[model samples]
Target: MFINMASPERPVSNGKRDMEIDKYGFTGGDQYTFPGVPGELPAETVRKRETKWLVMLDNWNIWMAKRFPQLKKRCRKGIPSSLRGRAWQLLCGSRPLEAQSNQSFQDLVSSTIPETATEDIEKDLHRQFPFHEMFCQRGGAGQQDLRDVLHAYVAYNPKDGYCQGQAPVAAVLLMHMPAKDAFWCMTAILTYYISGYYSQGLEVIQVDGLIMQSLLRKVCPLAHKHMEKLNISPMLYCTEWFMCIFARTLPWPSVLRLWDMFFCEGVKVLFRCGLVLLRASLGNVASLPIIPDTYETMEKLRKLDKNDMHPEFLMHAIITLRITENDLENEHRLQMKITKKKGNSSVKLVKRVYRYAPTLQHHGIVQKTGATKHLSSVSVDSSQVAKQTQATLPQKDKLHNDAVTLTVYRPISQSSITTLSSSHTSNQQSEGPNKDFQLKNDVDQAKGTYL
Candidate 1:
């Protein structure tokens, strides 16, 4: 399963063909040369590193068999770069090449005709890793490989199409493994780790931001309060962090460590990492050179040096954080409910806008009950406004019965207003605060951690 590229003379093969696996992988016939490179790995260096890799892989298998916790603890230390590709495959449970043929991917790429997504895929190709040599040159081997992987994915799932954030993710994957393996890893990320993230509406990413906001309030109340007072939405800074899995924000080494834990643990790692970043930045953000806007804040976050984010320190801090798996599950549940309710309202609004708005604008009256009736005022209740506002809030704040004030600047018809007020009264009477905001368990859990 191991392809030795220790010596230039050693011809690497994938069993089916005689190929030399270069830094990226086998590129048909060429040696796949880079701009500035060494002749070959020193014999001693190769032996030492490869021996360590083999021994580590063997130990991983043994621990995996026993379902031991030590394996995770060891993985937290970091996977060696030499074995990172294979280790990632093992983590995601990817099948061997012999069992899963590449012919299918080849055929799909060759046979599938370019459709609507062709333009999108082409535009994002060079934008992936412009600084890196592999992807620097236009139409270079790396860029071509990136295009193939993305196009194949587009054909694989046409409905989802192509998303911008996925390019960097795929590019990082390509750095570690071949195109096919990278494609599978991308699939695993989309399907299992972060479902609905790239889908239309990006519903999951939005919910995750709200969840982060909720967690931040508990983890760093002062920082959260500062951000809230400043009117900084979680969507401002966290969108890129969540969408790209911190690929665009953190240093490469730190991102690798986070990914290592993410694959082993799950989405909870992302929450922990977000909390860590905010916690680290709390003092700096609270004082001196105060962040001006979202752009400056994000730029400052991205520029955080390795000293501020040493892998061992960050990982240790993340593990020791009060956040837990159950907390994430509860936040996810709360966010899902809120997102669904909003989604339904949006759908209804879209339907109404398209079907009735144009006609309403043109004519002042409408036919109702087989008679022409003049449009009247729309009345909204005070309590109804409170319910709507509370629903949009995070779970932590939704339970409090805070009085809300609503201002209406525009005129509304009396009939519509009465109908709205009646509906609100009925809703207020029928639904209790506990039904929508019953989160005693979450409150108790947060108290245990926050106190």
Candidate 2:
């Protein structure tokens, strides 16, 4: 149902829906506002996405939780097929509001300047179940909806600009939702669910593979070991599953059903689902026995599309797979402990020994040493100085500070020289008494250990 935004002065459309609008009253990107309730069309006019099943390991969820006690209780149930889009939108917290709902997304999409729209959308556009009516229906309202949703997201987060994988997500959403509705879901998925993933630069999306590997290590150590032996991490096998949320890798219905769990649960669902796959294929992975090269391991795993991964069957496989509670808690606790330990270690190592490392030159360490008394003083640097003591310290330890120069300070006597110049001789004789006294004092200071 649509929320009615129109006041009495605003005219509602009385004719059938079409591509263009007669009234600028509801026109956007112009100097006007529309009068009418932005209501949802009746259910009769809406369409369903094309879907099929591949994996059917029945009772997979129950089996997984039972096998591994570490899994959290899913308070939220999976969304029904009919409401998957709405549920996903709700899950991502990206739904549109009445006053300003979807306006920014729509405005941004309309204004985006793409380098080449045809190749960008076309390359992966038809690849996603092109035979399906919902996605393949060219120039149809359905296609427009998918385009709007995808384009809006690309515009909203231009950094991730656009990628080939998003089509399947949008196409899948379109099959089950309106363009605007799917846009809301896309925002939620991109913002809250996979916020960093779809950016043009793909830095965050790439980072996720790293995080997934960490999770794998905890949940399935043995499986993780096998992957590491191959020197392959989640970067190798899991990127596509995440990129499309398993649209291409898993069957359509299987993905939709999985998404139901995903929206209700969040990303942990993806991890748990992945665990099921690893456990089910453990025998296959071990038998293949590949390792030490990430690409090689990946090549072996890519052949995992067994072509018969039905939902019920995977459900069955996961249910039977053995995962333990001790394993889950130990995994989570291990990561949490490591995180805390690293934070503490950094503070200790960077702690200041003196008031400032650079400001030490201004302190008493340099000014008090006797010139002849093994006179090496610590150069206090003040930059690393701490506020508590405000002390400047030398770079080396206390023992080395004074002993460095004592070994070279032996005084040599001036040899008796008979210069024939009488005037210069008198000048030298006058300065000799004061110079001798200074040298004697310096020598005495060194003998007395006055440093």
RMSD of each candidate?
20.1, 29.5
- Model 2 earns a TM-score of 0.50
Best by TM-score: 1
Query: Each prediction's TM-score against the native?
Result: 0.63, 0.50
lDDT of model 1 at position 121: 75
Scored by CA lDDT, what does every candidate get?
0.54, 0.42
lDDT of 2 at 379: 13
Give model 1's clash tally.
8
- True-vs-predicted CA distance for residue 171, candidate 2, Å: 0.8
Candidate 1 Cα outliers beyond 4 Å, as residue runs: 1-53, 56-61, 96-103, 111-114, 283-289, 292-299, 337-451
**Best candidate according to lDDT:** 1
Off by over 4 Å in 2: 1-78, 96-106, 116-119, 137-141, 283-286, 289-300, 305-308, 313-451
lDDT tens readout by residue for model 1, 1-451: 1111111122334443333334443332222333234333466876675575577566543334233255467567666667888777656544332133345667656657456677877887766645455676799988888888888777777777777777878888888889888877776566546656677666566566677877787677776766665566676667677767876566556677788877665566778888888878753544525665655655566556555566677888887776654455456565545545445432111100000000111012211111111111111222343355235444443222432211111111111122211111111111122232233343323321110
Worst 10 residues of 2 by lDDT: 423-432
